[model samples]
Target: MPYRHYLLGEDQKSLLDRLVSQFTLAEESHGSLALVYLDTFDWRLHQADLRLVEEDLCGKARIDLRHVDGTLLASGDFPAKVFAWDFPPGSLRQALEPLIEMRALLPVARLGGRRDLYAVLDRREKTVARIEFLAPQVRGNEDNRQALPPRLLVHSLKGFAPEARRLADFLEGPCGLTRSETGLFDESLAALGRRPGDYSSKINHGLTPALPAGQALRQVLRQLFTTLLANQPGVETALDSEFLHDFRVAVRRTRTALAQLKNVLPAREVEAFRKEFAWLGSITSPARDLDVYLLDFPRFQGFLPPEARADLIPFRHFLQRHQRTEYQRLVKHLQSSRFRALVCRWRDFLEQPGGLEETADGMKPIDQVADRRIWKIYRRVLREGQAIGPQSPPAELHELRKTCKKFRYLMEFFQSLYPAEDIGRLIKALKGLQDNLGAYQDLHVQVETLGRFSREMVAEGDTPAETLLALGRLVEGLDRRQAEVREEFSERFARFAREENQRLCRTLFKSSSPEQA
Candidate 1:
């Protein structure tokens, strides 16, 4: 049966006292357990309307996956685990693997709580409903704890619909209870000064069309700067590859924004920051490259034949060893004075007064500036994409890919200024083409990287001949896949350049100014 959760008021009387006056109640069970909620940095489980809690009682611990309504979906003994792969195969693992792909689960909140279960009885001494009181206290460092509002969970028993409905009415009317929309997990996050789904790499600055171009671009930069800082700790600690990935993306977006929205800021200031961001980008690339290979190791192994699969173990070890080295190097650079100064100065530039200098388009309305910039980039995309042919070099496709990325970024930054549905449709069409181009480029890089790594292993010695042979097969497989991706490029580009999409793009972005509407 479905249950309901309610948040009690601070000044409310004891629930047991309120209940005793209505009916005879019997204590069912009572216990105290420490609850630690888990989710990825981006709140993956919360996004899926699920909660995973690790309950520690005395010294023993168990993990539970539950719906927001408190229904148990799965439960198992808590093990020493970081990633989902660390769990022994079970329903819990099955549920988590897909949702948290390539991300590590981290404890988002912790609370020590006591739970008391009671049975509401009828005159005939029959149990008609169950009420559970959860008294949670937020657990913090140095044995400090903060108590939160107690929650009441009411469960309906079979053949007791009227009793449950009557009890709910009484509680709502006289007891002054209300439903809790966010439940314990989010409430705990609130107590800790955090919010679920607070971190995201996507750009949504809520820019207005009539806002000054300078002010609007500053808003976007501020958000991107926040994201860049938020992901820094995770990157330094090597929590997961996604930390570095998101951090790099924030940097790229900042650079792209400054470059595309030229004249909104002083040219010299923009150029200085771009150089600093470019340096940051360069330092982070080696680690990110190795992370990609490590993350793709399983798929790379699949490319080998069954008999040769074992040979790739050495290659995996090699990647891990180098991944560590790259991370150490990356972290050192991240902690260096140069990086620190850049961060401090960049923050000041984005946040301080008098930071933005006078420029040509600084005071222009954002909608006018956005329409002009997007239209120019759209023309570039069309020209570059149309110029590609079957005989064109991979470099040409690569240049077009970069152009497409800039066009997409501009649209996303100013997406609020356009009709959502129309803009979204155009982005979807462009994404298909981008995906094909991305895959083609990635395969080419992989083929080259494999050759480079193979030579390094040989130079370092102790590399078995069979491992090289297995790598050769992997490269051969990648070559075949790259050919396939390349073959589909024409069709993908055609779809993106179809008359329908072209017309939509023009309708949405081709105008020179809001007055043109």
Candidate 2:
């Protein structure tokens, strides 16, 4: 596998304590790892091609090298001796050779014996080092990816490990090859002729930090979830993709927490939590699907002519009404205090020394806690639903619905632990059920939104045949989804629902062993 190495800089001058050459194998193409020390080199940065830098994840940066080619090209201490220009097509090497002659080079004598200072080494290794420098949080990136060779694309300072970021603190600046990146390059170059390893296992191992299975996995999840939540979908349709991602993560983590720290939780509790997550994922499916399909309509319409779009009214109208219905349900579930309480409760449960249900499922100000409480609420709903008729216990069902939402929230919250496949299956099933429920719900809401439109049309006295037709189409679509809930659908859905409910409770109450705890 191709291992990745990063040398992040807080400034343009990353004074990496570890030399680069020792980090790589002597061979031209082999993966190696280390954190050695090196000297420094002089490099120049340009006002052009700053775009070569990665997007600023450390907030923002001051390095702005604007150019038509969208690249910043300038020689730092390790100046490229312009021998030829036959590289990437359409390059400007030919036009800039005269300016790069050694005459144009700043004299080493005048440079105060800067004398190409670099990390001294006796061996060479094969490793590529990339660096990114972000300014202070107020204006993050200073050097970013600009100072290093373009091959080493700097993505974000935030992505760098803590130690790397600490090193970057000394590297960012107006100069190219932040002191840190320069130091790495100098070290690598210095070791050009030396053996790859110094023949010491302790030294090699100490140079590299290895993440253990326990905490490291959690960290990766945290970073990933942070990324997903940062970009919310515009409409419901996009929710599925996010839902899938979030739900799966929760599942994986749920399993991981269960297996790794078996002592921390009981097996039953882990199963209960997983089950609830599965159910929660199921209920949220229709809303996401409806949202996604409807939101994409506007773009899809662009492909048609005006006349075609005019006739497309019924389709668009149906989709819009569908959206309103799904939205109401989603909002109701999201706002339920029951779900909120569960999040706090779940967090408490997870953080505690005991297992999932050492205490009763309690409620709290949900907005204030981690997302798992909602999922517990979801489990609660299924339990409540088990006791009453779907129609007779409207109040109970409504509360049940609330619990379903809580589950979704929880699944989304602890998604870092869940598996993607598990979540995907649950989402598919929920979508199937939601398709019918969502339609019924949409009709329930659209009747109101369209009623006003109808009144307006009547007041204007317009011959709005399309309005009636559009409304009819939507109503029909809703009817169609419900129409199929017959023997086959009933059997399949019923079986799935039973299974889902079981899983919810199973997942809710899962636990681990004391030793593993």
Candidate 3:
């Protein structure tokens, strides 16, 4: 049985109410179509992972996406067939993401006598997929397909991509399947050349350091990445995006874990990953930025009317063209052999059991790996902060900020084994430090971008002077807007950071005995 399913709530209701007079997909054949049944709540969370959303949007859950699925499933239970796939969790997350985000775009067809929601065909009109709930009358017949009241999900797909796995993930990622949906998902998968426990071996780790708890949290970062990148809502193929997200996560986690377990893994490997990730993060920035810009651009435009928009449009065009070219370049960078080799090496590293070297004193290395290094990085950052003067170079300050973030995340990830309150305090202080530095850096980037754009727009005066003047005004407005935010930001930061040293001391050593947070 598929673990989840996605159905139209309105259609489910209509069908449950025996009111699905509008659903034509059930009676109709959708050539090469697929339908996956997903539990609305689980699917969205499972689809758009918390990390990506948090990093991209907010620290807290966004209500905008919350309950979106249940809301979609506004109606009650209906007899439905679900198509299930037996794919790796990673693969499954990747495939079904699109449907979660693009439900509004899905074309509805009816199944059986119901009409509200039934089948979906892909963008290209090659196939149609519909799901039908078992008839109540036939559901009691044990010998028939309706006997189990199989929750049904159905799908039609083109060549090459495994339809069952792709379809199953699509259905199950957010909305879980019903008892009946599960039955149908299983039945459908069997029909399409898959059975339970059928799938490729999962790559469980990619550049991770053993935690102080030893192997308990070995691949937390990888898991985070797998959940985020693999399940991004768009893109035709699931593997690429999933892998990308996982890879980014693996990098981040491994880096964090290394900081926490510096005593275990070779320091050089930790440094190497940190350096590589800096490049990887840059490559991914275009994609991530584009995503953010797409979300907020309309709002940004709306802040001013067409007059302001007309001024900013050229800058927008420049931004778009630059982003496009940069994206293409980023894709190429991802495809480069160097990148693949790094991934392969990372995979090889993760497969090995690392950390905890046994010594002559009969002491376990992992014991020290967690305790000693955790406080050590914390101490170093604090000392560095004290030692560095206002005359410190930006490079030094930037390094300091990176160290704080690393330790902050480390504390959070391993809070299960730490003095929670103190670590939380430290995290807050580090955040203040980062906020100040980050805002400064963002302003710098904006200013630099503006200068470049101005030159490009003003070249040879091909367009009217009004457009240039408007664009210049637009950039000035943005700068002014940013400057406004910068004001009072420092005072808040200073208040938060003044006692960072005391807070770190209290948090790191708060426990009287060895205990987990």
Top of the candidates by lDDT: 1
Error of 3 at 96 (Å): 18
lDDT of 1 by residue, 1-517 (tens): 1367787664334766887888688988778847788899988988888988887755788888887766788778874367989888998988889998889989888888787778989989899999878888987645578798888878887678789888888788788888776667767888887888888888877888899898999998889889999999999999999999999988998999999997898788789999999999999999999999999998998998788899999998899999999999999998999999998888888775253446888888988889988988988999999999999999999999999999998988999999899999988999999999999999999999999999999988899999999999999999999999999999999999999988887887775565443
Per residue, candidate 3 scores C-alpha lDDT tens digits across 406-466 of: 6666666655455446556666766777787665555545556656667776773465666
Candidate 1 similarity to native, TM-score: 0.92
Could you tell me the TM-score of candidate 2? 0.32
Residue 310's C-alpha lDDT in candidate 1?
93
Ranking by lDDT: 1, 3, 2
Question: Which pairs in model 1 have colliding backbones?
Answer: none
Q: CA lDDT of 80 in candidate 1? A: 32
Best by TM-score: 1
Worst 10 residues of 1 by lDDT: 349-358
Stronger candidate by lDDT (2 vs 3): 3
* Candidate 3 global CA lDDT score: 0.45
